[model samples]
Target chain A: MNSDSLWEVFINACLINNFVLAYFLGICPFLGVSAKLETASRMGVAVCVVMLVSSICAYFIHRVLQALNAPYLQLIAFIVVIASTVQLVEMFIKKASPTLFRALGIFLPLITSNCAILGVALFQTNKGYDFIQSIVYAFGAGLGFMLALILMAGVREKLALARLPDTVEGTAISLMIAGVLSLSFMGFAGLG
Target chain B: MQPEKPIVIRKEVVRRGSADEFLKGLWRENPVFVQVLGMCPVLAVTNSAINALTMGLATAFVLLLSNLLVSCLRHYIPPQVRIATFILIIATFVTVVDYLIQAISLEIHKSLGAFISLIVVNCLILGRAEAFASRNSIGRSLLDALGMGAGFTFALLCMGGVREILGGGTLFGVALFADNYQPWVVMILPSGGFFTLGAWLLLFNRIKQRQQRKQPRLQARLQEMGSEQ
Candidate 1:
């Protein structure tokens, strides 16, 4: 585990293989909350924190499920764990930072079904990463998601004033921008 | 404790015929384009027509069955446990579909991979089960599910057909262009999925906008004719 090298995991997650652009995870929030830069960054932080915690929990329970030889339990266990973790995180945020809570509170429940958090847990287990590797991978995935969210939010802010055609005003234009962004993310395909 | 009160509620609550219920999903409440629910498959499996079709069928099946079951059990399931029960029901169907796909065709199963299971988390199925099914009659719930399922399938087919034709230079499997035709290439990739859906959404929105613009013109012309008469 010590020799696995965390840099590769970080790079592989953050840039080489992004969650939103590459894997198509967290796209609902990617489109919904990305209308404002501040909101996007807040949601990104919330997702990052939840992803980290869910990864830790998923890694441990996964071992127990493997020992019990109940492979089918993976979906239910991961989802329940993630839902509770989001609840826990939401409470903590409410107590710790009221202002931050206000910004991210609404999106907190939405994170339970984000799929990226669940995707992190599932993919890390699939790759058979060690405990430390799972943590780093989760962190990387979160940061990658955050980066994508921030970038899209910035663009959308600028687009607020642009005069797009009536039909392509909101979701349509956002998707087109995301498509082009996904194309750009493909440039990193050869890095790793 | 008779079934008469429930029937009154059903009759009063659901005024529209089944056909109206079904048509809404196809156009106004389309799961893909209009409501924009279940986008993961909308943008993912649409790289090919056959894959998209298979995925559409699987989702529709799960959706139709789940809606039926949820509607039947709505009165039994307490409101507190409704979400969990819904999740469990959805996961069961997804697992069944996952295994059934593997049994039917290993290649298609392999192609779909984790996404087959991810259908459980799709907002569309849960959204429908919660929003429409839980409160409505079983017959109406069935209509809603079928409409949504067909609308979702129609949207996927549209995306898949365009992507397959442009990206692979083929409709389903047969080659359409010449042997030397230079395919767009990008259409088959992940990015191509985003591009194709985005373009289709743009087209749909433009058509909708044009119609909205015409409605006012027609109204104004009617008023002018009324004054002249």
Candidate 2:
């Protein structure tokens, strides 16, 4: 693997191409948990933890799969590995810190299916990132996800007071807001 | 055990009524718009109108089938093991859809990719199964699933239409303008998703306020007639 600068990898992952905004991964939690800022922030941190661990685990697992010449097993294997890891993490958190667990407990299992986590693993494998790069990319992706969630949460919080129509009150409006955000992100297209 | 009270027994049946319960998912408690149960695919796959249609259809199919089967087998499956069973069933259908899409075209399949498989974890499907389908009949569950699926599809289509038009300067892959038309590339990006959705929210609120203003005037007129009566 070619050695890449950590800062370069970080900037690329976080800003130029975000997981939710650019890559279109982990949008489920981005919208579901983003209804409230408190929950969104907590979920963001939880997801960051999962992304870090999963990225490391997936990098090694991908190497093993490549050695075995069983790339077909990639998707299912990644999902199973992520699911079991989340389970273990959940149990550890439950036993270790009930308070932190309570704050982030419900979101832990949800991370197992978060497309962003798996997407990071897949992207890292495809891009052929080294160990350090994989970790940095994961960190950057998590930060990106957090950035989008926080911005959305802030806007949605203010939207709570707005009198939305009976027909298109919640999801429809949130989606339109997402459309505009997607538009603004275009300004960054020439950055890289 | 003490004899069951008639009111309590009836209350249980009322709560479990299939048709009313199922219909509720369409409007009063729409999984996408009203309840906001599933947001991942709603936001992610809706970049293009066609993608939105396919994703919405796929999700609806999963929701409908899973709800029916889960409701049918609710009695046999123990509560402790129900979630596992539910995931297994949902995953099986997702696998079927995944292969079917692959067979159709690599391009569309590539675009959708893992988001299709992730439908298994979409809170809307599982949430309904646990909360409604587990208790309702096959017929009621089907209607509930249909209603929610359509509602979700409608929402996705709306987002996709706006994004595709502004972002790509086209609709459903057809260019609306000539060579001079320069698409606002941001509309297709991540932040554009946020700002577009936010503006739509504001617009929806404004329309709602206008309607609310009209309602009070109409109510006042009705009250005047009532006073004469």
Candidate 3:
């Protein structure tokens, strides 16, 4: 719990090693749901919220597992916890705001299986981040995810009008774009 | 008079088309190239030839087994619970692969790490099972899985081959030239994965375009002959 530099944690999470671009976590939604900016932003916010809560929850869960000497169950338990938490969130959102629920829709449940949420938990536990650091890291990671999604959405929106062959019209092209984006991100490696 | 006018009609037989269904996955609806379903592992583990092969084989095993099992029990599985069932089956196979990898060698297992475990969450496996396997027979499901798996593997290997050559200045860990060859270290980095994949895709698109151009002339000539008929 040597808690000191929070900004470093944030910068590291957001840029030096982006969740989507660098780490390759949460790519499912990054590609699947990032067709529109609005949806991508909403998904980003939702993922950020889940990351924050899960990070806090996982801190406790990690401690509990350590106490019980059952670290092996961490992955399975974390998944179950995240899934149930998402279910609760979905029910709450549905009861509270129908419009928002519709916007988020299937992605809410999708958060249950999203690797980013679990990745954050696993990473935080592995890194042994303090509470403040964990929160900052989660926020930064969420922002990073949002940044990548927005950029991708912007590119994809324009790409719609561009001429593409039938063979590489869809997924193949998207992957190629991701590859280029990944290459650009490499330039930022020396920044940190 | 009406009773004497009764006519017997033959029912159209619905035969299962196995090979067509399976072969379609190779190019028509390739999991990686066409559907782009499983990009996570495609981009992540394809930094090297060995990793690409390992990931490909592991995914194929899971995909094949899950497809077979899901197809076999498709009728009994309620629609609502089908996804859960498919995931559980996938997770079981992933666990088996994970342990088997660990038992065999630590280095390769370490390289693969969470990606192997994350196979349970790979949408491609569940996507195939729910969309294709659940509807087709067990045999057909296996073929489809094999085809899709092969396509995915082929795509991964292509990516890996390009990345390893440029990124590491070697192929399959073998040094092709002398030590003077300085590899573009960036290729080995995360960004290299994107560049290699994108370039390869652009190449694939160009080839496909050439093929499309050649198809219309052939089609037009066939139409001219049909008019004569």
In lDDT terms, which candidate is top?
Answer: 1
Query: Candidate 1: misplaced stretches above 4 Å?
Result: A1-5, B1-15, B219-229
Segments in model 2 whose C-alpha atoms lie over 4 Å from true places: A1-8, A27-42, A59-77, A97-99, A102-115, A125-133, A149-191, B1-28, B177-182, B203-229
RMSD of 3: 4.5
Candidate 2's DockQ is: 0.40
lDDT of 2 by residue, A1-192 (tens): 756688888888887787777666777777688899999999998888889988999999998999999865665666667777788878888998899898986788778768788778877887889998999999999998998898889999999988865656666666666656656665666766
Candidate 1 per-residue lDDT over residues B1-229, each given as its tens digit:
6978898888865566656899998888899998889888788778889988999999999999999999999999999989888888888888788888999999998888777877877899999999999998999999999999999999999999999999989998989999999999898887888888888888888878889999999999999999999
How close to the true structure is residue A107 of candidate 3, measured as C-alpha lDDT?
84
- The lDDT for every candidate, in the order shown, is 0.89, 0.79, 0.81
- Fnat per candidate, as a fraction, reads 0.52, 0.49, 0.49
Write candidate 3's Cα lDDT for A10-108 as tens digits. 888888889888878888798888788888889988888888888888888888998999866676666667777787778888999999999897789
Model 1 interface RMSD, in angstroms? Answer: 1.2
TM-score-sorted candidate list, best first: 1, 3, 2
Evaluate model 2: give its lDDT: 0.79
User: CAPRI verdict on model 2?
Assistant: acceptable
DockQ of each: 0.65, 0.40, 0.50
Evaluate residue B49 in candidate 3 and report its C-alpha lDDT on the 0 to 100 scale. Answer: 91
Q: Model 1 lDDT vs. the true structure?
A: 0.89
